[model samples]
Target: MLDLYDRRIVASLNSKYIDSKLAIDTLALALKKHSPKPGLLLHSDQGSQFASQEFTAYCKENAIVQSMSRAGCPYDNAAMERFYNTFKNEYICRYYFKTDEELNLGTQDYVFVWYNYTRPHSYNGGIPPSRVRFR
Candidate 1:
């Protein structure tokens, strides 16, 4: 999950399939890391993983208000689209991981170290997301 306020990646996971389980697990990780108050708004694409009954129930149980992009409108979730573009070009394309474990660790490091703490973001006036978030 990405925090729109600061552009921080609150949680993420990699899986072979985009299923409700993956959605729920990633959301659970975000919840554990940051205890947002009730009525938190979660914006996402209208994918089956995000629209499934289990995922909906999980959001409701966590007091999250879910919002989805309009059908076939990627612009509605432009931030996420941009994030994925950057993630792919800046990180994914630079390395080859031979194992899932390596990929997971590499992803964690990228989000926690490089992306959040070091990389400059145009949205935050060329500062890192962590700086903008924690300043």
Candidate 2:
């Protein structure tokens, strides 16, 4: 997964399995590259990935404030939710992954090359994210 901030991919990772501590570590490593910039308001759902003790500890260590929505409220993380929905609908659902590497490479291409450089986002003045970032 790649974390998007100001439409730039700050980090990238390949996850065979998703674990809370791994997620925290990946995020922390990424944030370390941009340290002293206030802090991240890490928002997530009540999933185990965000609720784990290790994850919370990492957040505290990094001065990241954790924010979660009320139970059953998806809108709280609506941007991510919408992105996932569009990703699955437009890419994953239509493709067959013969290998994990293939899937990872395809995802990298989609996020970095296609989504950021080609696809236009309405929220970003109807231009691709890459252009907006340069602006």
Candidate 3:
């Protein structure tokens, strides 16, 4: 969900069905479109998703520097933590999803189309993520 260069969220979905390998591959694909230069700093906590062999290898192959926060330090990943909190509060908190499919679709719609194109972000000078990127 972290858009590294833009410092905005790229996408989010509610699904425990995603595996670490798939997450890694998805990130690589997104990065390909947004960051082709490589060598970007990808900071993440030591979650299995970030620490998976596929992810590590992708970083290595792409010339990205993978930075892991120290264990037990919430502040180390404050941005992502704050993002999740906002996501939950704004979207997840209000909805009672009856099924995984519903949650997945709703979250995808919020984070991708609405959040990116319509929602104004205070942190980005009150512009939507899409405007900040394209304008």
Candidate 4:
């Protein structure tokens, strides 16, 4: 869900359970929203979902290039590492959720409105990710 260029999160999902189907669905939804071009690069860790045949076929059909992080190497996906750290430190740890619904809503608000639109990134010259796109 990380945008390599602007460091934006294109989409996210939360649920009681997750699998390849959920990953594929989120990817489809994200691409629909963004209208990705051919040769678009989608980088992710070597999770089972990302490695699944269904997800691989979808990416291939859509002309998206897939790059996976190396095993045991966090630096290969440093952007996601930084993002997860920020997310945990700033929002996830600060919230006290009593229900799944509440947690989902809070995550949605934090990712979409606060993280993408309001929070500034040092990599983006202190501008929000939504305002710092290269294209």
Candidate 5:
């Protein structure tokens, strides 16, 4: 999940399936990393995983408010879309992973080391996301 305030990727997971389990697990990671107060707004695409009963219940249990983008409207969740595009073009597409473990480790480095700390984001005034977030 991407935190809008600083354009930071708060949590992420890689899986062969895009089911409720993956969604819940990713959210759980974000929650563990940053314990945001109740009533946090989680904006996501209108995917079945996000709308599944288990995911919905999980959000409610954590006092998170789930908001879905309008049907077929990517603009509603533009930041996430943009992030995915950048990630794909800048990182994922550049390398061919030989194993899931390699991909996961590479992704961790890209997100935590390069993207958050080294890469400059225009929305964050050309500074890295971590700088904007921690400043």
Candidate 6:
């Protein structure tokens, strides 16, 4: 999942049942010394991962409001759609992966070193995601 504020990936779980573990891990990483205010919101699609019982508890514990897109409505989450489109077009579609490790490493590089630290986003005033302030 991408944090809309900085476009930083807080979690990328590839599993059969993305349970509360991913949510806990993501919240831990994203909220490191950056505890959000009471009304702070974390928006996502209405995926099972975001709606799991563990995820709900974690959000309650952190006092973060969970905002989900309406069912069957992708337009409500346009920014995230854009992010995934860019991810697929720029990275995934361009490569022929020979192994799972190669794909994982490539995705890590794209998200961390390139997307966050190097690539400048027009929406971010031509600054990299790492330089943008939280919303």
Specify the highest-lDDT model's number.
5
Taking the tens digit of each residue's C-alpha lDDT, what string does model 3 give over 1-135?
Answer: 576444567544444655676667667666755775758777888888788888788888888888899999898898788778878899999989999888878887887777777888776888776777643
Q: What lDDT tens digits, residue by residue, belong to model 5 across residues 27-106? A: 99999999999999999999999999999999999999999999999799999999999999999999999999999999
lDDT of each: 0.92, 0.73, 0.75, 0.90, 0.96, 0.77
Q: How well does candidate 3 score on lDDT at residue 39?
A: 80
TM for every model, in the order presented, reads 0.96, 0.81, 0.81, 0.92, 0.97, 0.77
Q: TM-score of model 2 relative to the true fold?
A: 0.81
Worst lDDT run of 10 residues, candidate 1, spans 126-135
lDDT of 1 by residue, 7-30 (tens): 889998999889999999999999
Residue lDDT tens for model 4, 62-100: 999999988988888999889999999999999899999
Clashing pairs in 5: none
Model 1 lDDT at residue 111: 84
Which one wins on TM-score? Answer: 5
lDDT of 6 by residue, 60-93 (tens): 8888888999999979788778878888999999
Task: For candidate 1, list the clashing residue pairs, or say none.
Answer: none
Winner by lDDT between candidate 4 and candidate 1: 1
Clashes of each: 0, 0, 0, 0, 0, 0
lDDT of 1: 0.92
- Residue 129 shift from truth in candidate 2, angstroms: 2.0
Once model 4 is optimally superposed onto the true structure by TM-score, how far is the C-alpha of residue 58 displaced, in angstroms? 1.7
How many Å off is the CA of 86 in candidate 3?
1.0
Candidate numbers sorted by TM-score from highest down: 5, 1, 4, 2, 3, 6
Task: Report the CA-based lDDT of candidate 2 relative to the real structure.
Answer: 0.73
